[model samples]
Target chain A: MRVPEVLLDVRDLRICYETSRGCVKAVDGVSLEVYAGETFCLVGETGCGKSTLALAIPRLLPPNARILSGSILFKGVDLLRVSDSKLQELRGKEIAMIFQNPMTSLNPVHRVGFQVAEVPVTHFKMSWREALATAVRQLGRVGIADPDLRSRDYPHTFSGGMKQRSMIAMMTTCKPSLLIADEPTTALDVTIQAQILKLLHELKNEYGLTLLLITHNFGIVAEVCDRVGVMYAGKIVEVADVTEVFEAPLHPYTKGLIDCVVARRKSKSRLNQIPGTPPSLLNPPTGCRFHPRCAYVTHECVKEEPRLIEVRKNHLVACHNYEKVGGVSWSS
Target chain B: MELLVVEDLRKYFEFKKGLFARKQYVRAVDGVSFSVERGTTLGVVGESGSGKTTLGLTILRLIEPTSGRILFNGSDVTRLSKEELKHFRRSTGIVFQDPYSSLNPRMRVKEILERPLKIHSDEGEESRVERIIKTLEEVGLSAEHLMRYPHELSGGQQQRVAIARAIILKPLLVVLDEPTSSLDVSVQAQILNLLLDLQSRHELTYVFITHDLLTAKHVSDFIMVMYLGKVVEYSTVREVFSNPRHPYTASLLSSIPIPDPKLRGRKRVSVVGEPPSPLNPPKGCRYHPRCPYAIDTCELREPELLEHDKKHFVACHRAGELSFREFLADMDSFLSE
Candidate 1:
């Protein structure tokens, strides 16, 4: 398969929030690229700053979050330096986002059809009548039953699955080049989650849209993503092809996460849990953020941070003891 | 011997539409029956509106059940007086899904643990404090954590504190409603292991309620699958996984995504359409609308749960004729190889 052209290029992205205690380094020095028609997944635990890095790509951070340094270049235009009006034009047209919670993100007072039509009417300058028709078509496209009748209903009338489909329809109606889905199926049940995931896969192929999926569920990453980046303490500790990362995870943190999940899944006995918790972002460890809980931790691990080094053609690892810690190879 | 027995449990909430209007009853948990043996786990699996939580709550009498018999150690506590009910509740505790919200935000961990002991027993405060510290240690928290509030702890630690409180009273049964659903996988493992260890140590019977099939399989000795406030299937964990009788159970097990990437594109039965509303369930078999093997007779009569084998019960009329063994064999092949 030929690699699609790179549509969004993020380099050295750093974001910090001004808190009373100190400056919380939410996203620190993250760099990656999303190809034109591929799914790039950011997999990590809660509070790992994957969401913050995603928000930084679209310049959607709040007023208090300072982008300390870095550049988000999308289609040759630096999103950090774009004018407010130009950014507004690019938001819904060039890039669209689907948030974690669809209920809160959707406008409660408006009808579902009008809320979905809001994006196309505002961005493409389509008339209300035209946008309404387009919105109904998009709803039907997402496998929503009786779109015409249901479109007139409010968000409360729709089930969790339908509301999610509406959210997806709203995000994709404009046919944006890239879609950012941050935990889109977290609020849904397994059955509904499967449906939504299948819908996203079909839509991505149908529309030829690049996808940036941020989720903590590794199972989802394995199913949907082409390439995966494992984040820890606001940094991309490992980045590789989806199969390679799952099969041959190199970083200690990635290995721990995989082991933790795999162990719990296989044994009817007690799960082999990873000791300790994720470090606080406000005062991260001196060197590697994962060094505190790493089983193969060494003095060097605490003294010098490991740079992401290519261990294979496409696999990267950011651990000092990657070559030596060899009881169980992640790559089966 | 039956450690906990619930027969024909029903909990309905009445809503009035107008000042002079008739009342509308929301049948949250309508006529559910099951029993748990001593030192065993009975898992209740269902969808969001399937009333699994309401059933657990009703069993504990946290909310009054409209009519039922909750026999704990051969004593029916449903009709107990307020004083007797308070005493009965101390012997049967509950752990909620969200640990952060369940624990009082303003109270320290120590106080949270001690409040239960203070209410139920006449033990001195000093001894209760020691018991609290010991229980905290058992759940993997330290005495240092005693001074921390719920906000200061991580999700896992707060859940541990919640478990410590539930077990401090030495309850005969603990009703865990999706206890680990809100937690990360690693933290979920820790909490689950803790629960198992505590169960063995205390010889406690547990009614674990969750929609997660994997967790249910790992924790429960017996599993009951519910749909639209009805028990569709009930059997041993091994039997349910190896030979699921009901169509709903088969669909649910197949819907769960195995963590392994090698088994990604395997073929399995996937149930289509969402669950029907409980307010107005379908005629006859509530599951016939989605059942792939539905016959005309299914829509005309509801199937009663019958004993297909010793300790295995199924409610589908065609469950005996269905080839559940073939389905399990296919799933095992996909998962294993």
Candidate 2:
């Protein structure tokens, strides 16, 4: 099978928030790429800058957050340098994002159909009637039965799963080249979460859309992602194939995250838990953000930050002792 | 031996719709019954609005049960008077889902920990502080943390402080309402491990209420699956996981995503449609609307929870007839389509 072409490219992105407690380095020097039809996942714990990195792609960061450096290239156009009018034109047409909480993202007073069709009408200059028709079809595509009737109902009328499905329908109604889904299934139950993930995978294939899936659940990343990027303290520490990351995680943070998840198949004597909390973003540890909690921390790990170095064919790890870190090998 | 026995427990909240209109009864805990043995964890798993939290609260008599018997130590605490209930509350403590909200923001960790000890025991203030410090250590918090308020700590640290306060009273039964749900995965493991250690050390009984099956399976000796205010299935963790008798139980287990991508295409039972409202539940079985094998009998009469094995009890009319493997295979095809 031929690989899809790259659609969006992010280079050395840096984002900082001006808060009372000092400038919070939210997304610090992060870079990633999204292929035309591939699912590239950003996996990390909360406050690891996965969401910040995602929001930066569409230039949707709050007023307090400013992009200190870097370029976001979509079809060779730097999104960071684009004017507000141009960025607005590119938002729902070239890129769309699905937020974590669907309830809050949706307008409470407006009908579901109106909220969904707002983008198509505003961006594409389509008639209200024509946009509503398209929105109905989009709802049906996301597996909501009786879309025509349900579209007229309010957000409160729908259940959690239905709300999430409606959110997906609204996000993908324009058929943007890249879809950034930020923890879309975290608020849902296991069964509903499974259905949503399956739906997302189906939608990705049917629309031939590239995806940037953000989640804290490793299980979700393993299931949906083709390539995975593990972030820590606003930096991509490890990037590799899904199978490689799961089978042989290189970074200490990634390893600890994998260990923390309770696998359905693994029957262990005791669950392995990583000790200590993630460092604060305001004053993140000097050299390596993960050095404080890393089990194999060396003197060099504290003095200088490690860069992403190719360890194997397609695996990149940012650890000083990638060659010597012991335990379960990733070759299996 | 049964340390606490709940027989046909029910809690209903009556809402006055209008001045002269009829009232509406919200059946939060509808005729649920289960027993907890000494030194064991009974995990109650369900989705939101499934009455798992209300059941936990009702057992402790924090909220009075509409109708039922909560027999602890062979004494029916459900029927106890307000003053008498205080004695029962002393033996039972609750840790809520959100530690930040549950703990008072204004109070320091030391005050929160000492309140329970001061209320339940007649110990002097100086000795109580020492005991509070010891409890903090047990939950993996330090005495330095005692002076800090809930806002000063992270989510995990606040949860640890909550655990210290709950276990400081040495309650025989502790109702943990999603104790580790709000914390991060790594911190969740630490909290769960602490709970396990404390349970074994004190020989305490725990009613762990959560929607997370993996965590439930990790800590619980026995697992109970609830749907629309009903206990659909209750069994040993190993037996329930390996060979789920009830269709609902089987579907819940299969729905959980395993970390391995190779198993992504594995067969799983997927229950379609949302659970019916508790205000007007289904006629016979609450799960019949979502069950794959719902038949005429299932709609006509509710199946009583019967023991298929030594300790496994399932409440499905077609439990013996339905094959979980075949159902899962069918669901996989249906879902993929």
Candidate 3:
């Protein structure tokens, strides 16, 4: 068996925001590894810290946010300890990130092609003329029809799907190995979303990219992820192969989420919903953050946090009562 | 019996191309017609610029239609006078897509739900309070939430308050426009189940407008597919999912990403491009540019919606000649080594 090379390894990452009320633990002690040329997904609800953990890898947290502890090693180099100028050199050329909203990400005043060309020009010190040529080719490759004419057009003229395609074209200009897409298709329509997902899949294969896809939608996870990580509050509760995560989810939180999506396909039966809202991150629940909503909650879950432990081959679950949790088989 | 029937409804918003160019009409709801039965849901599924929300609002008379008849309970709602329209609105309700923006942050839950009652009813204050309490309980909220402001409630609880406000008058028809799109799956499931339970208990006719296919399939008895402000296909939910005739409908059904890795590994039939702009929609069929099976005739002439099978209507030039399921099956096998 060929041993997969580790591309990005994050260990014990604890990110927090110093607000007026208190310090909000956005991502608390998250440790995961992204293998080379594999798509790893972080699936969770809103404010679950999946985005925080992803942003921290690029060292792109907001001003108020701080990484209290942990190390982010990309290709055996510590990204957290790197100099600001060194990080900037590596940002667009080696590690790139795309945001959820395409409208705000690109400057509305500039032509779309110029913005895309700026990536290579700034990162690699390429000539503007050559980079612009590359920009047009990349635009065409991203499925933009009439690239020559559309490339000259402003961002406002591009549709939502077109803008996202342009964003992808711009991001891939440097041919970055690790692409962190945070809710890439959340703003698109269903058909357009399908088109973008297909484009991302094609690009992943063509570039041999290591993708860290963050989304709340399970369907996207099932569609693209090779492995899945189920995050709650600020910690990952379960990590497994894509099929195992769906077929035999060990954690109760993971089971509840899968059941929510699958039960809808079986006609008008009452949907099984997880009771209670996600706890506030200001003072996240003492022990397991999901224990308040977990069905198999016990006293151990309330008093102590369970570290991620391998319950089976390559299947890790962070729950004290994995033995008690029911298996969730895929119905369809 | 049909609780709500719309005939040849049209809404056109006029805007100038440039500063001095002649005014052109954006045919938002160019020509739409459908009916909701007494106690069943009619799901309106479409992408953006499809005018599903416009149709919903036009039915409620929030936006006056340019032409056509809106018959609610056997009366032309468009012809009603101002006072008569006020009375007509009491029989209908609407829930918007975002609960965060829909509910005023400053107002307490009690005041937000109480506004609808005050506008429609002339009952005493004591009775109005009693009705509000009862409606809150029905939507799974207790009296504790009544005094709390909208910001203090969670998204699911806020949506429940929105539902409670919509049904507080005991309206017969409710238009829910993407009510659960902004929620988590678990919370979304709770809201959907609550809607279904409320629907059966109150015998409410619903026009559920959403872009989520799974949620639509769960709650709707009938599904309506719209493109560029026109109904492309209309049929029972079973028929639409099982044997879709229109290329657009087939593309929609095929585009839905099912939550299974095995199916994901199999080939998916993705429609090629983005939807065209509403202002400059294609001449013949709006979906022809993106459809996989578009022929020369599809670009030249529009197809009228006609019954291809029993109780299933489709607007396509080649509705029955091509089998979409066979196409998908062939694609799946053809792509897999």
Candidate 4:
């Protein structure tokens, strides 16, 4: 089988947020790629800049955020170099993003149907009536019962799952090629979360869309993601096939992270914690950001930044002690 | 030897629609019966509206139970008056979720931990300060943290302070409501380890409540699964996880991704649709509408929580007949399709 073609590629992306103190280096020289029609996940802890890197793809950075230098190559077009009008057109037509919490992302006062309808109306210049009709149909596709009636309901009237469904409907209305869902099921229950995951999978297949899923939940990454990218302090630490990464995690942070989840364990033992906290991006540690917290800290690891080196086929890890960090078997 | 026995406990809230309209009763915790053995952990797992929080609060008498007896050491807590409860507070402790909101933002850590000791015990100022420092040390903090405010500490530190306060009194029972849910995964593991350590040291019984099944399985000796204000399945952690008895339990277990790529294509029960409203819940089995193996009997009659084995309990009409493997197959097909 031939290697799949790359859809979105980021090269030397750096993002900084202006605060009262100084510039917080959120995304520091991060680079990764998303293949067409594949679910690629970026897993990291909170404030690790995975979300910032995601938002930067569609130029959805906040007012205080500044993109110092990067080229977001989407279908061979540098999204950063694209015109403002072109980026706006690119947002809903080719790339769309879902947030961690749809409660804040969605307009509470507006009817859910109107929000979904606005996507097509603004993107395709459809009439209000035509868009509403299309929005209702899309809502039904997401498994929200009584699409016509539920579409008329406001965000406040819907459950966490329903609100996410409406958001999914709005995002995928135009069949955007890349769907960036950031913690889509974090606020939802396990049962409802399964349904949402199923809906996302179904929609991904139906639209033949490449999905960039950002989440901290390893369970979600295993279930839906085709490939995985481990992000730590704004850098892509490891990138590999989901199975390869889970079975034999290369980076110390990746191994420590996968070992943290309770479900992934083979035996009942104390969870292996990544000691210390995620470093403050305002003034991160030199060499490797994760070296301070990593269990296997070497002299060079603390002095020299390890490049993302591929030790195995299709598996990349950024760790001076990648070979030392042995594979932990998850199969019990 | 049970430390606490909750017999057919019920807690309901009345909401009046209009000035003269009939007040609707929302049955939050309906006839839940369970026991907490001394020095053991009982985890209550459920969705947001599944009454897990309400059950915890009611156990602490934070909310008045509609009807039931809460026996603590053979003393009825529900019957305890306001004056008598002052002494009772020494025996029970309650730690809420969301440490940011739970800890008083204005108060210092020393003040927060001191108030419980002063109220529950007769410790002087010097002894109180010493006790505070000792308790903080137990939760992996130090004396320096006492001077800082809640905002000064990280999310994990604030939670440690919260846990410190809960155990300072050395209460026989501490009702911890989703203590680890809000923390980062790494921090969450530390907190879980701390709780287990504190439990062993203090000889405490914990009512660990959370929505995450994995966390629940890790910390709990006995797990009580709640649904729509009712106990659907209550059993040992091994039974609930390895061989779930109730349809809801099996569905919930399968729905959770096993966090292994090898188990990616594996089948899991596909439970769709939202849980029914607690206000006007279904007449018979509240879960029948969403339960895949729902039969006429499930809809017609409410199944009692029956004992399958010595410790395993399930409330399902077709618990014996409906093979659990079939449920896993249903979920596998749900994914394959």
Q: In candidate 2, what are the lDDT values of residues A1-332, reduced to their tens digit?
A: 77657688899999999999999998999877777788999988879899998998898899999899999999899999999999998888778899889899889999999989987998889999999999999999888889999999999999888999999999888888899999999888777898899899998998888989998888788778999999998899999999888778888778877876655323222556788898899999988889988888999999999998889987888899887654342221
Best by DockQ: 3
DockQ of each: 0.46, 0.47, 0.55, 0.50
Docking class of 4: medium
Q: Please, what are the lDDT tens digits per residue for candidate 4 over residues B110-197?
A: 9999998877778689999998998899999999998999999999999999988888888899999999888888888788878887
Clashing residue pairs, candidate 1? A247-A331
Whole-model lDDT per candidate: 0.86, 0.85, 0.89, 0.88
Candidate that beats the other on DockQ, 2 or 4, i.e. the better one: 4
Candidates in order, TM-scores: namely 0.96, 0.96, 0.97, 0.96
For model 4, the stretches where C-alpha displacement exceeds 4 angstroms are A264-268, A329-331, B325-337
Cα error, candidate 4, residue A55 (Å): 1.0
Backbone collision count in every prediction? 1, 0, 0, 1
Better of 1 and 4 by DockQ: 4
The fnat scores of all predictions, in order, read: 0.38, 0.48, 0.62, 0.56
Tens-digit lDDT track of model 3 for A220-307: 9988999999999999999999999888889999999988883235566677789988899998988888988988989999999999
lDDT of 4 by residue, A1-332 (tens): 89989999999999999999999999999888899999999999999998999999999889999999989999999998999999999998899989879899899989999999999999999999999999999999998999999999889988888889889999999999999998999999999999899889999999999999999988899899999999999899999999988889999888887777776543235677777778888899999889889888989978999999888989998998888888874433
| Number of the top-ranking candidate, with lDDT as the measure | 3
**What TM-score would you give candidate 3 relative to the actual structure?**
0.97
lDDT, residue B246, model 1: 91
